[model samples]
Target: MPARTQLSALRTFRPSKRLKVSAVALTAAGATTALALAGTATQSTSALPAIDVAKVTAGSQAGTKVEGLTQGVADKAYPAYVGKPTAAAAKNTSRDLTKAPAKAKPAAAAEHKAKPAANRSTVRKPVAVSAPKYADNLDGWIRESLAIMKAKGIPGSYSGLHRNIIRESSGNPNAVNDWDINAINGIPSKGLLQVIQPTFDTYHVAGTANHLTDPVANITAAANYAAHRYGSIDNVNSAY
Candidate 1:
């Protein structure tokens, strides 16, 4: 070959080989850099000193200085590390321990005293009343009927009741007029005041026995009828 041609061929082939050498060199450099970094990390890990927990605790308790630990850091780590109280703080504590509490103000005490108690009236217990007692006789029946009539606003008296009862049935509670006009109508006049069944039932007062032969019931009913028809039993002189 000629010299120029050989020189050109050598230049093109040398550039390809140079490119490969550069790539291989770059790969080796990167591998070496990675190995160096790993070795440096391992050395750094081995070189670090192990922490002695017991020594740190002893140093903190004894108030001795721990290596690389500031006083603030020591206080945060060990809460038992308390600084001495200042002179003013000690004096204030002593005063608090020895001093007596303040008394209530005189004006407040006076105002409390001036306030009056509530005006509560005492409630009295109710007095129980006993009912009136009566004898089991004609006088008793008439008297009892008068009391019931007075309460019911029926106008009659003991005298009027006695007079009518004597004329009608002669004071007999079980007296019956079976031959009278009322009896002929299928209704007999019965009891102390000789009241018929219909009249007795119609004018019957409450709180009295509902029987035709009952002395008090008979008197009260007859008196009630008389009062309605003749203004009062006292005004009726004959059968009504």
Candidate 2:
């Protein structure tokens, strides 16, 4: 073969290095584009909705913790999935419980507490105090004797008692007449209103001392005798 014909045949059989590299690069680029398109189609089918970057950044800056962002995102996108008035209902229940004490306080206080200040004046007061029935003195003795006498229908006076007591024993309650005719007869006249023991015993008034020498007992016995024999002690002017 001629030299030029041989050279052309070699060129046809083997390509240049630069052309080979260029061809391989073009094939690689085409394959990369096809793979990118396939990835884009997959992303479009299952991609999450876009987040508000500004809000996320602001929340991050304000140090707010993010939780359940996917669910929160859905709730924010659809208004019908929002919460109900449960918080408001709970608040109303709390308010009703707080007012329950106020409603119940009046009834409980009316049953157990003291009377109100407005009604205090209408309450009945206690009865007035009266004097005691018994006293331990001479005046007390006379008053008690008079009370008993009045009960038994025995008539006498304070002046008459004073006169008789003075005349009989000069107001000496313990005086006794041992030398008198009654004493000689074995019965002594004794006490302020002097009378023999027998006479005192015979005319002894109830609710008085049994001892004849007792002043009140003696007076009471003598008065009782006078009441029966002479109608009253006031009628006894002298020794009976």
Candidate 3:
């Protein structure tokens, strides 16, 4: 061949088998590098310690337990967070409600029993009072006159007879009203009760003395005359 044709052939000449061998070697090198890196990562992860989840939960057997926590911390914190009352306090309140009430006296009875005596405004005397007394001589004459007047169905008291005798005779047994109206009519009054002759004879008690100056006889006759004129000698306070 000429020199120029030989140079062209050399430029176009390819080593096909050697090229295939180099490509195959490069693929094998890359595959070997990837496998080495994967083995190194797996061995490093397996060398660390393992964790047991069951043993951590088994420490708390009574109440619920959180992960990585003990029972002591949960027991102390449960009461502070939950403020509801317990069963024992509710039972004590129920016992107190079941007890009986105490007995007591009424307010009106206490007030009535404790009232003071000074508060009573209408108190009164418990016994009756008696009339006044007179002298012995005058008392005897008046009492005797009252007895005779009573027998004749006439009404008179010792107090009434004594009062009239004091006004008429001034307690004199032989008193005479000679200057008064009875004397002006020619009939005068005499004795303790001061009876005139006509009045003495007209109203004389049957069993008594028959003189105007006799004390008991004069008193009885005068009371009888007074009873005939007025209602009774007790009703007469002035001269008849």
- 136-202 per-residue lDDT for model 3 (tens digits): 5877778767777877898888888888999989999888888988899989888987888988999
lDDT of 2 by residue, 1-240 (tens): 455654464344433465456545666668555334433443453344445655444444454533425444544453233332367786886765644443557778787666556665696888999855856555666677777788777889888877887898887778888897888988878887898888888999898889887767877888899999998999988988
TM-score comparison, 2 vs 3, better candidate: 2
| Candidate 1: regions farther than 4 A off | 1-125
Best-fitting candidate, scored by TM-score: 1
TM-score of each model, paired residue for residue: 0.50, 0.46, 0.42
Each model's lDDT comes to 0.77, 0.69, 0.70
Error of 2 at 142 (Å): 5.0
Q: Decide which is better by TM-score, 1 or 2.
A: 1
lDDT of 1 by residue, 138-186 (tens): 9888888889988999998778888988999899999999998888999
lDDT of 2 at 46: 39
Which residue pairs overlap in candidate 2's backbone?
none
Extract clashing residue pairs from model 3.
none
